[model samples]
Target: MKYDPIDSNLFKKNRKKFMAQMKPSSLAVFNSNDVFKTGADSTMPFKQHRDIFYLSGADQEDTVLVLFPDCPDPAHREVLFVTETNDHIAVWEGEKLTKEKATEVTGIETVYWLKDLDKKFFEMMTQCDTVYFNTNEHYRQAVEMETREDRFIKKTKAQYPAHNYAKSAPILQRLRAVKEPEELELLQKACDITNHSFRRVLDFVKPGVWEYEIEAEYLHEFIRRRSDGFAYTPIIASGNNANVLHYIENNQQCKDGDLILMDVGAVYANYSADMSRTIPVNGRFTDRQKQVYNAVNKVKNEATAMLVPGTLWKEYHVEVGKLMTSELLDLGLLDKADVQNENPDWPAYKKYFMHGTSHHIGLDTHDYGLLWEPMQANNVFTVEPGIYIPQEGFGIRLEDDVVIQESGAPKNLMGDIPIEVEEIEDLMNK
Candidate 1:
């Protein structure tokens, strides 16, 4: 919990939106993420489930949120179940949230101990006809490990087989896709922190510096600014390592006249900002590198324009592909024959630019948005386009976080951050 406390109104509004979508007499439950084990006694740092955090603003582990708007008892309408913190437990694990503070953080009037959940939840389950179960239904999700929410679904089904079960994922998917004004404020803060880190790295990076050192510079800035950390695993690949896509090793030394592809961001109040930028270690891109860099930047700018409202997610990428193809042609990386002979599934542009151009981004890096649906306002996305040339020992990518607007183009969250080749070089040399 390195970040500052979020405004409870955001959570309150989120809960209101969720409840409005629920069918009459239906109750919903959201579970915090489990603290994963690294080894026997070693456990990975606790990360709150984004959904619970979204609804309740409760960042603590082992917490549960119950929404029973139609409960017979008025006090049971909205409740938070937090682990009870006693004197002995406080001494062992530091201080956890107390009942008073839990109410303050969540704006939930009723708070109960985790020990009282089963008895109370059973009482509500019998009163309600349907239960809204939280499940991960993001398109990119390939969850192999059974999550806390999964176990809850299984156990609840067995416990109340007669009660109708409903999916909360669909409601959440649509709701979380649209950002509230308060959510945007937190996301902007994350982007501003990332901007500071990127500027610091620009000055710190030079020939002979290890790639991991640059990664350290980014994390140091993020931590000092009170960001939880990188939104996802950072990619600090230097020179040809940038072509490898998911290069987290960051062990290679940066050389003069080479580009470093940093796909990094910061998380503030659990909201994510994703950015990717390629910069020359020597603070000046060579003639050939400048050509490739501008091409990618051009592609990025054009791709971002496609994120406006009412655009299909798949259609936007296809249009972006055409944009990239034109840039690749001008860069002499692809010719007319290469474009003509390319397979429909794997286009000619995939040779230099393999991965996707944009993805929904917010709570998670690859966040919740139905890919099959048309783009809408308040939907945040990242525009990342890269041209990787392994043979030339360099890769170029330029990215910015953007929000889909009601009309015109999406607003670029990272627009203030330096991106032009001249601007980056001048900032680094300064």
Candidate 2:
């Protein structure tokens, strides 16, 4: 891991919170993500499943965590199974966590090798009537690939069909939504790294620079600052490309007068920071660009202020849409008729500002949070509002990651990053 070690107490607290919600006589299991294959001899990078990482602080593959708070034996209450390391394996793959190291990292004193998992798990299963399985239930999830967790759940069911099975997704969704103090610190670090990268881009971007070049600049700064690369696939959209919400090809050359909408972030210690900023290709924004940019910035500020406790996710978006409607009207993109005749399903503001203004941002870019529930303090979210004007040959978006507070306005994680039209122009020209 490039980042510094996280305190194991955080993981200890997370496990305690999760186990508190588990049914009596129940055991919960979590598996690390698979190292997916690219082809015959190549494989994609390993990313630990966020759920397991959240509870164990074990950022390695082929690891498993079991929690049985009701176990008769105290040693079996919380156990961690890790792949054993040997001389040959260590030479080939570097240092893997040993038993003592695993305990230090996860705060679970009972550690066993992966080879003994089946024997130990079977013994525990006999004592518990119910089992909790971690499943992906994020609202934006569209996973088709069978994961390590999937195979474990399938085999467990086949082996112990009589056991009462329960979903761990709901419990995790609620718990992971609210950031712990340690998590908030990591998120702030990620955002601070992103700020450095964005400032670098401001100095590097020129009229004729290719979008990929800007992407490379961001990557260079991220790695140098100890980040684990981007939080998500970056959107380095230039010109009308910004109109395509997920545009990541990054192959176009930025024209002199066009705006480049960059939806990018840095990840530190598995915590994610999401930020979106649109700036002119040239040193300064055109008058019209400034108008639209300020409008989007205003909407972002107001939308962030609405992220206080007790705000419903859906209702918050509805309110943000009204704010965008007013901005679009002032921009002359929507007239009185456009507002009056707008379809209730897709409002008039959809013509320009189509996407939602905010979403939970943390471990995963679109982190777990129940949409129906009211917002709470410590819930981190991205306040992004944009106006994509294809007809004008450019688009503008300004976003910031914010933490909902117990009182007053939410704290903007990306607050120090340049966003104002003049500030951006000054930095670019400097």
Candidate 3:
């Protein structure tokens, strides 16, 4: 692993919290992600399942975590089943986590090999009345691919037909939403990397640079800073490309006076930082560009202040919509009559700023959090507000990761990253 070791206590605390939420006599299982293959013998990089990684801190393939909080043997309460490495695996794929190292990483003293999972899990199942199966219940998830957890759930249910089943997603969604101090530290590192990379791009961006060239600059900075890379497929959208919300081709040449919208971030130790900034392709934003940029920046700042504890996610966005609506009206994108006859559901702001104002940001870029629940202190979210005008041939979005506070304003992780028109211009010119 390129990243520094995470304190195993974070994983321990996570598992303890998760296990506390489980019903009595219930055993939970979490499986690492399958090593996805692209073609014959070629494989996509192994990314561990965020749930398992969150609870176990074991970022490896072919690993499983079982939490039987009510097990008769206390030592077996938290067990990790890892891929046992031999000479061939070590020689070919490098070092897999040995039992000692797995224990050191996960704080789970009891470890088993993958081959023993079935027999051992079956034995544990006989003692527990219900089994908690980790499932994908994230709002944005549209997984067509069957995950390792899915396979495990199928086999477990078929093998133990009489056992009651439960979903672990709900508990996990609540637990993972609030960050521990250690998790926050890791996230801060990711955001700091993103901040530096954005600065690097500011210096690198020019009138004639290709959008992909900008993406490459970000990637280079991220790698040099020990980041795994972009939190998601980067959107280096220049000019009209910004109108297409998910534009990631990054192939178009940036023209002078055009604004480039970069929706990019860096990942540190599987934690994610999501940020979006629209900047001038040239050293300075044109007067019209600055007008739109300031509107988005104003909305972003106002929206961020509403992220304190007890704010509901949906209501917060509605409030943010109101803010964006006012900004758009001021920018001449919306009129008073447009607001008067606006569809209550769609609203007049959709004409210029269509996307949600914010979302939870953590292990996954769009991380898991109960949307219906009130925001809590320590919960992290992105405050991204945008104004897109295809007719103007450019869009403006400004984003920053923030942590909701109990008493005051949410802490902006990207606070140091330049967003002001003057600051950005100064950096670009320098």
Candidate 4:
């Protein structure tokens, strides 16, 4: 891991909170993510499962966590099963966590090799009537590939069909939504790294530069600062390409009058920071570009202010749509007739600012939070608003990560990053 070690107390607290929510006499299991294959003899990078990482602070593959708070055997109450490391394995791969190292990292005193898992798990299963399965239930999830968790669920059900099963997603969704103090610190670090990368890009961007070059600059800056590259696949959209909400080809040359929409971020210690900024390729926005940019920035600011405790996620987006509508009317994109005739389901503002203004942001770029529930303090989110004007040959979007606070306004994680029109122009020219 390029990032520094995190305090294990956070994980300990997370596990305690999760266990408190579990049904008595029930055991929960979490598995690390699989190292997916690219092709023959090649594999994609391993990413730890967020749930396990949140509870155990274990960031390695082929690891499992078993939690049984009411277990008769105290040692089996919280057990960590890790892949055993040998001389040949250590030589081929870097140092794998040993039993002592695992205990230090996870705060779980009982550690067993992977081979002992079946025997130990069988013994525990006999003691518990219910089992908790960690399933992906994020609202935005569209997973088709079977994960390691999926394999575990299949094998467990086949082995013990008579045992009662429950979903762990609901508990995790609620718990992970609210940030612990330590998690907030890691998120701030990620945003700081992202700010550094964005500032570097401001100086590096110019007319005739390829979009990919700008992407490379961000990667260089993020990696140098101990980040785990981008939190998501970056969108380095230039010119009208920004109209495509998910543009990531990054093959276009930025023309003199083009506006580049960079939807990028940096990840530190598995925490994500999401930001979006549109800047002129030639170091100055045209009058019309400035108008659109300012409009988006205004929407972003107004939307961010609405992210307070007790706000409903669904109602919050509707309110943001109204804010965008006012901006669109001011921009002459929508007139009185357009507003009167527009459907309430798809408002007049959908013509320009089509996407949702905010979403919970954290471990995953689109982090987990129940949309039906009211927003709460310490929940972090991204405030992004945009206007995609294909007819004008440019698009503008502004985004920042924010933490909902108990009073006043949500705290901006990307507050130090340049956002004002003059600030961006001055930095680009310098």
Candidate 5:
């Protein structure tokens, strides 16, 4: 891990919260993500499963966590199973976590080797009345590839068909939605790193710089600030390229008159921050570009104000659409006729700002939170609003991560980053 270690108390608290929701006399299991293969000899980087990481603070692959709060033996209540490290494995790969290190990282005193799992698990299965299966239940999930957790769930069902089974997703969703104080601290650290990266790009960007060059500048700043890397794949699209929502081919040279849309953020200790900003490549937006940019910025500001506790996720977007429509009308992109004649399914605002204005952001870039439920305090989200105009050969978007406060409006974590046209221009010219 490039970043510093996280405090294990957060994991301990997470485990307690999760166990509180489990049925009595039942056990829950979580598995680390697989190290996917790219070719015969190559493999993709290993990313720890967020659920296990949240509960155990174990970031390595082939690790397992078993929680049985009602166990007769207190030490066995919260157990960790890790891959045993040997001389050969250590020499060939790297230093795998030792039993002592695993205990330190996870706060679970009982650590066992992977080899002893089957024998140990068989004994525990008979002792418990029910088993909790960890399944992906995110609203936007389209999981085709079977994860290690999925395979474990299938195998456990086949082995013990008579045992009662339950889904752990519901409990996890509710618990993970509200951030602990420690988690909020880590997430704030991530947003602070993103601020450094964006500020660096403000000075480096100019008319002649390529889009890829600006992306490189952000990456450079992120590493300097001890961030692991971007929270997600970044989009550094300029001019009409910005119209492509997910554009990542940043090969175009930024023209002086065009605006560059950069959607990027940094990750630290598995926590994520998401931000998007559109700036002129020439260190100044043209008159018309400023108009569109200010419109998008206004929508972003208003939309963020609506992310208070008790706000419904569905209703929040409807309100954002109204805000975007009013801004678009003021910018001359939509008229009175465009408002009335537009289809109800796709409002007049869709013609300019097509995508959702915000989404829950945290551990993962698009973090987990039940959309059907009302928003709550400590639930972090991204307020991003944009105007894509292929006809004008440019697009503008502004986004920032915010934490919903218990009282009053949500607090913007990226508040230090420059966004207003005057602030951005002054910084760039400096």
Candidate 6:
């Protein structure tokens, strides 16, 4: 791992919190993500399943974590299974985690090799009356591939059909939504790396530069600063390309006076930071562009203030819609009739600002908070508001990751990144 070692206590605390919500005499299991294959003799990079990593801090493949808080045997209460390392394997694939190393990384005293998982897990399953299986239930999840957890759950059900099965997603959804102090530190580091990279891009971007070149600049600075590349597929959309919500071609040349909408972030220690900043290609925004940019920035600021505790995600967006409507009205994008006759379900602001204002941002780009639940302290979210004007050939979006606080306003993780029109103009020209 390029990132520094995290304290195992964070994982320990996460496991304790998860187990506290488990049903009596129940055991929960989490599996590391499968190393997917790209083609023959080649494989995609291994990305550990966020849930297992959140609970164990074991950032490796072929690992399993089991939690049985009410186990009769204390040693079996918290167990970690890792792929055993050997001399030949170490020489070929570098060192895998050993039992001692796994213990140190995870703070789980009991460690076993993956080869013994069937035998050990069967023994534990016989004692527990219920089993908790980790499943992907994120609102945006559209996975078609069968994950390691899916296979485990399928086989476990066939092996022990009579055992009461429960979903770990609900428990994890609530717990992972809120960030730990350690997690907050990691997120801040990711945001800091993103900040540095954006500043670098600000200096690199110029009229006639290809969009991909700007993407390369961000990637270079990210790896240089110990980040694991981008948190999500970056959007380096310039001009009309910005009108497409997920434009990633990054092949167009940024013409002078056109705006480049960059929705990019850097990842550190498996934590994610999401930021979106739209800037001019020629180092100066046109008067009309400045008008739209400031409107979007104002909407972002007001929306960020609403991320404090007790704010419901749905209601927060509704309030943001109203704020955007006012901005659109002042910008002349919408008239009074557009607001009066507009469908309540689809407000007049939707014509300009289409996407949601904010979402939980952490482990994954679109992290794990339940939208229906009221906001709480330590819940990290992204406040992104944009106005896409295809006719004008540009879009303006200003986003920042923030942590909801117990009192007062939320803390912006990307607060130091250049956002104001004047600041961005100054940095780009410098």
RMSD (Å) per prediction: 1.0, 0.7, 0.8, 0.7, 1.1, 0.8
lDDT tens readout by residue for model 2, 136-209:
99889999999999999999999999999999999999999999999999999999999999999999999899
| Candidate 2 lDDT trough over 10 residues, lowest sum | 353-362
Which regions in candidate 3 have their CA more than 4 angstroms from the true location? none
Would you list the C-alpha lDDT of every candidate in the order shown?
A: 0.91, 0.94, 0.92, 0.95, 0.91, 0.93
Where is model 2 more than 4 Å wrong at Cα? none
1-430, model 3: which lDDT tens digit per residue? Answer: 7798888999999999999999999999998999999999999988889999999999999999999999998977999999888999999999999999999999999999989987888789889999999899999999998888888888888899999999999999999999998999999999999999999998898889999999999999999999988889999999999999999899999999899999999999999999999998888888889988988888888989899999999888888888888888888889999999999989999988888988898999999999999999999999988888999899888899999988988899888988899999999998
Q: Please write out the lDDT profile of model 4 over residues 109-204, one tens digit for every residue.
A: 999999999999999999999999999999888999999999999999999999999999999999999999999999999999999999999999
Clashes of 5: 0
Report lDDT (Cα) of residue 265, candidate 5.
Answer: 91
Estimate, for each residue in 1-430, the C-alpha lDDT of model 1 and write its tens digit. 7777777888899999999999999999999999999998999989899999999999899899999998989999999999999999989898899999999999999999999999999999989999999888788789899999999899999999999889999999999999999888889999999999998998898899999899899999999999988999999988899999999998999998888999999999888989999999888889999999998888888788777888998888889899999989998899999999999999999999999988888888888988899889999998999999999999888889998888887888898899999999899889
Using all chains and alpha carbons, the TM-scores for the candidates as numbered come to 0.98, 0.99, 0.99, 0.99, 0.98, 0.99
TM-score of candidate 6 to 2 decimals = 0.99
Candidate 4, which segments miss by more than 4 Å at Cα?
Answer: none
Consecutive 10-residue window with the lowest summed lDDT within model 1: 1-10
Return the clash pairs for model 5, or none: none
In model 2, residue pairs whose N, Cα or C atoms come closer than 3 Å (at least 3 residues apart or on different chains), thus clashing, are none
lDDT of 5 by residue, 228-268 (tens): 88888999998899999999989999988889999999999
lDDT of 1: 0.91
What local lDDT does model 1 show for residue 372?
90
